[model samples]
Target chain A: MATILVHVMPKPEILDPQGKAVGAALPRLGFDGISQVRQGKRFELTVDGEVTDEVLANVRKAAETLLSNPVIEDVVQVKVVREGGCGCGGHGHGAGKAEKDLLA
Target chain B: MATILVHVMPKPEILDPQGKAVGAALPRLGFDGISQVRQGKRFELTVDGEVTDEVLANVRKAAETLLSNPVIEDVVQVKVVREGGCGCGGHGHGAGKAEKDLLA
Candidate 1:
């Protein structure tokens, strides 16, 4: 199976209050290096087979119609990720302690 | 000066209802390839300087304390993406139309 990652983030023109809250809270917690924060939604999709163009296209349609608010947000990216469990291209999953691979 | 992407996903044992909903809905919308869906949080942080270890460490602390439920969820991955506006190793941003970079 193929794992697809869909990242839906707010449009630049929209104000992200949750992100602002995180930014404000971080400084208070001593995470000083961050200048800004923007919050978003990530959907990890486990598909039935190889990640083909038609599969990606349908996922894109899902992103536009159901995943995000088209008026205020947009799908920033759609990625074909290596499945979970095996380190195909691990990304940073191998580096993290509690990482879970949905593909597994 | 740097853009760090922190992705927090539920631990494998944790139940992800939203992801299940998305997975269930997609097939109805004709996206038949998706077998399952896992929902998570994506935080785009614009930091003040280069993405050094010190910066990442503090962000890790933030992820542990403020961002996720340590008991149920985990930080699956963290990455430094090319800044918002520029195309340096653009990942998939260049391919999508509504993609927005917080660094810009």
Candidate 2:
């Protein structure tokens, strides 16, 4: 199993009214020190089996075709933070049951 | 300077059409192994000065009030990845120029 983290942000050229609004409000709310408050989203995904290059490529395509607009969004960076191990210093398929149901 | 990372997702009770759509498309796209493909966003903010506990709390409140919907979203985790240093083992006021302009 692998855990992937992804971030999506608007293209730099695009006007981020949400970000701008937050920027304007931060100071008024007593956060005078806060500025340039651009906001985005984060996802933590637990995928069954190894998240290899091919698997991640398909995931990126899915993100592009459905999750975000290619014209307005920049990159869909995918990073594998942890790899599956039984804690015995070896591959663990035994506990994949929980993840299987999630993926199923 | 400090870099804060935030992740936002639909409350588990809410319907995630984007996540569902991507989940359905994954298998057909030949990524048969992929399942439970939920999508969210990530942000990396470079803030000038120290992001103390009070500063971080203010940031979280701002995020709750403007960036995210408290009713529909949960958690505004702000992690300070890096602290100000001249990289010379001391507080760096000299090079905060870039971040200051951004936060300004």
Candidate 3:
């Protein structure tokens, strides 16, 4: 199975109170250096088959349409993680570049 | 300035109602191929200086202590994005490996 990760972040112009609250709490809790924090949603979707381009397109559509509110958020990322690979490890550079192009 | 991306996901044993609702709605909305779905939080932290090892270490601590609930969530990723790089584009290889080692 291929796992797809979709990230939905608040638009730059939108206010992110949850993120602001965390940013405020961090300083109070002694975590320093961080000047800003934006909290966003991440979705991991386990697909039954290979993550073909069509599948990716569909996932992107779902990310934009169902996973995030276009009015206030942007689907910042949609990438596939290889099976058995740690979610953070398999960025799939080729896929990533292609997806970015598609987004552009 | 540097950006750190932290991903926190629900533990496998935990019940994620939000994810389940999205999963159930996908098929109804004509999006197919996804077998399972899990929702998580992604934090984009903008730091005022270079993301040194000390900064990463502190961020990891913050991620575990304040960004996520240890009982139900896992800080699956803590990686730095380069300044001027799109958040999705700067998963530094050496940094990623080091962070994974630190987590291990």
Candidate with best lDDT: 3
Tens digits of per-residue lDDT for model 2, B1-104: 66555445566576777777777776776765665655554444556887777777666665556556768764424444555321111111112222221111
Ranking of predictions according to lDDT:
3, 1, 2
Q: How well is candidate 2 docked (DockQ)?
A: 0.26
Give the alpha carbon lDDT tens digit for every residue of B8-103 in model 3. 888878999999999999999999998888999989888887777888888999999999999988887777777634356322211222222234
lDDT of each model, Cα atoms only?
Answer: 0.69, 0.52, 0.77
Worst 10 residues of 3 chain B by lDDT: B92-101
Pairs of residues at least 3 apart in sequence or in different chains that clash in candidate 2: A41-B41, A41-B42, A42-B41, A42-B42
Q: What is the TM-score of chain B in candidate 1?
A: 0.75
Candidate number that wins on lDDT, 2 or 3: 3
> Per-prediction count of colliding residue pairs?
0, 4, 0
Isolated chain A TM-score, each model:
0.76, 0.70, 0.81
User: Which ranges of candidate 2 are over 4 A from the true structure?
Assistant: A81-104, B28-31, B44-46, B83-104
A1-104 in candidate 1: lDDT tens per residue? 65677777787678999999999999998789889998998777777766677777787788778888989886776666554421212333332122222211
lDDT of 2 by residue, A1-104 (tens): 66554555676677877777767776776765665655554554557887666777765665555555778765434444456421111112111222211110
Residue B6 lDDT in candidate 3: 88
List TM-score per model, in order: 0.79, 0.64, 0.85
Q: Lowest summed-lDDT stretch of 10 residues in model 2 chain A?
A: A86-95
